[model samples]
Target: MGPEWAILGATSVSLVLGAVVGLLAIRLQGIYFAMSTLALAQMVYFYCVQASFTNGEDGIQGIPRGVAFGVWDLSTDLSMYYFVLLVCGAALLAIARLVHSPFGRIVAAVRDSEPRATSLGYNVSRYKLAVFVISAGMAGLAGAVKAIATQIASLSDVSWHMSGELLLMVLVGGLGTISGPLAGALVLIGMATYMSELREWVTVVQGLVFVVVVLSLRAGVVGSLSGLMRRRLQAAPRVSAASLPGASAHTSGAG
Candidate 1:
């Protein structure tokens, strides 16, 4: 199948799966929801490991780099890169719009305090389920692109470690901000490449970074920087006002 087919198939499957799981799991929150999803993931993983159609760990290999609608040949690395960029750009744009929409506001409201949202006559459960499905579909699209880019689909791609890495990326970059995850991914990828030789210590380093961010910058890199810039802007007016000759004198006289 072609890129379009693969992407559509991935997203559709994820949406279905997410809806089913979310319907069953959305009533639960925090660790319970996390555990439920983890259990589902384990089930999928074992199925992949046992299923003959999945190649039993060897995975689906030799996947062809097919052309895009017969117009762009993805066999060439440059063409494939550009195609990936296009797909990613579109996805990011869609995500931006989604996060800024009224639906997104409802999602945020639900997340902050479900009881309050419910009291306000909002269907918190439905909103949660819908967002869950949307998230899964987005993840599926990413997975589809990844498989195409690497030309391989393996169990490792679905492992708990992979899930943890995705969480870490959002935390490191800053949650609730579009640029945060992108920046976090670039940082993590760059670090991984640089430390490829010292792979054993990579996790240790990442953990240390995580700790530092948690203790000193709860808002994460992007969030912290944004806050700092905002604070500076706010303080600038006061500083300029205080610098005026009459302003200081007036304040001193009042004191």
Candidate 2:
């Protein structure tokens, strides 16, 4: 089967699990929501571990890099690379578009002040659930890509540690900003590649790096840089009409 079938599987998984979690979690707010969702995640992880269909901890492996739409051969590394790049690029663009759409604006509004959104007659819970489901589906899409690319899907995919790593990526990348995860991923992947020799210490070093990022770049790499640029732009002196080279002559002639 091609990648399209894989997407359908992922999408179905997301709709079922994500909707369930959203139903349970969306009514609550803040840490409560996080805890509730994580509780479900823990359940799912164990289910994956024990379930027969999931290969009982070993997971579904030996997945082939089949053709894309029966046209593009994904057997070669170069072809796979381009395929992944195209998929990722499209995902990012779609996410960006969604985040800027009116629906996104409403979601942001609901996020900032639920009471206000409610007062404005918005169905806060529905919006929260929709966004939650969409995000979960996208995450599933990522997992599908990783599984297909690596040709494996193991227990580690749904493990608690994997959840922690996902959180770390968001924190390192800047929680709400586009391109933040990409930068964070690059740093983490680069470290993993270079420090493969020190494999055991990689997690420790990652924790240390996370600590550093938390302490120093509170807004994250991309977020902090963008903030800095914005601040500089704001701080720079503004030029008045009187400061223009021809302003005096023009003003005198007018007078």
Candidate 3:
């Protein structure tokens, strides 16, 4: 298994898993959808634990650092970094395209109003299921890539905590925005990587960050910024219109 092949395999697996989870989420909606996904992920975690190939507690160690194209060595850090970036970027682009498409709009509509969408002759549940599957597939892709990157797959990859962490990442970065999760993943992963000395306190730090974001920023960072930009854009046109010569006369006459 060359490094390129390994990465490709991991990415493909993650994409399928993400799509499956996304499909499930489409049906459940709100807290129900979340809980459903969490439960499903836990089932996977247990399965991995029981599976011999996963090595249970010890995890699948010493995974081969396969070569690149029979020419480039991926055992090196630089090559591996480039490979990860390329794969992740491709996945993100796919997600972005999905979000901007008509199907994506339908999914959003289902999120906003399933009953209304159904009334409009759309099979809301089916659409939701499809999207849930897609999201799950993407998540799986991420998991597979992660496993390959670390050259190991443990029960931890499918654990509820992993799912929770992903949710938190999206929330902190700004849900409903493509870039939010990427940013959130960076911050969370970076913190975890560098805070090895304070490993015991990492949980506390993470919890505090979640608390602050939930309390002070309901929309998450990106969402809040987007809202601010929209408000400013809207206000500019209003201000300009109001300042026009006939604006005050019209307002006074109406009054």
Candidate 4:
């Protein structure tokens, strides 16, 4: 298939898979949903390992980096990078739109208080299912994109570890924030790349970071920064008012 077609196929497949998982997960909350998704991911990983087309341990290697626009070769790193960036960007944008829509608001509402949403005549389960499916599809898309990026799709792509890693990225980057995952991905991936010699230590570092963030910073890094900015904005008016020539004098006299 053509380069664009391959990307389209990967994106579509990911969306479908994410939607399916999301649908199933949305019915349950908290740890149950997490466990269910993890199990599903493991099942997919095993399937990839056992399936003939995926080539088991050897994986589907040397996948042809197809031609883009029926002209530009995608095999080159530069071309592939741009292609991936574009696809990932588009996916992120799509997700952002979903999160901002009325439907997304309902999903958030369900997350916060399913009973309330249900009482309000909204099918909380259905919304949860829809969002779960969307997230699952996006996860699948990420898997497919990574496979294409490396030109190999193996058991590793669907492993529970991979799911855990994605969850970590979301958490570290700030769940519920559009840019968090991207930042988390970059930081983790970059660190892993640079510390290749200590690959085993990566998990330790991630765990420590997670603990620190959870214990000390309820909001992730981005969330905390956002709060700080909000506080500054809110305090600006107070500061300006206090700076007025008679403001402090009048307050002191009144006291």
lDDT of each: 0.87, 0.88, 0.77, 0.77
- Tell me the tens digit of each residue's lDDT in model 3 across 41-141: 78877888888888898888877667667876667778777877887888889988999999999888877887898898999767766765666566656
lDDT against true structure, model 2: 0.88
Off by over 4 Å in 4: 18-24, 239-255
Error of 1 at 247 (Å): 13
Each candidate structure's TM-score, on Cα atoms with residue i matched to residue i, is 0.91, 0.94, 0.83, 0.86
Steric clashes per prediction:
0, 0, 28, 10
Pairs clashing within candidate 1: none
Off by over 4 Å in 3: 3-30, 69-72, 237-255
Model 3 residue 179 CA deviation in Å: 0.8
lDDT of candidate 2 at residue 87, scale 0 to 100: 86
Error of 3 at 88 (Å): 0.9
| Every model: Cα RMSD to truth | 3.4, 1.6, 4.3, 3.5
Candidate 2 residue-wise lDDT, 86-108, digit = tens: 88999999989999999989999
A best-first ranking of the candidates according to their lDDT comes to: 2, 1, 4, 3
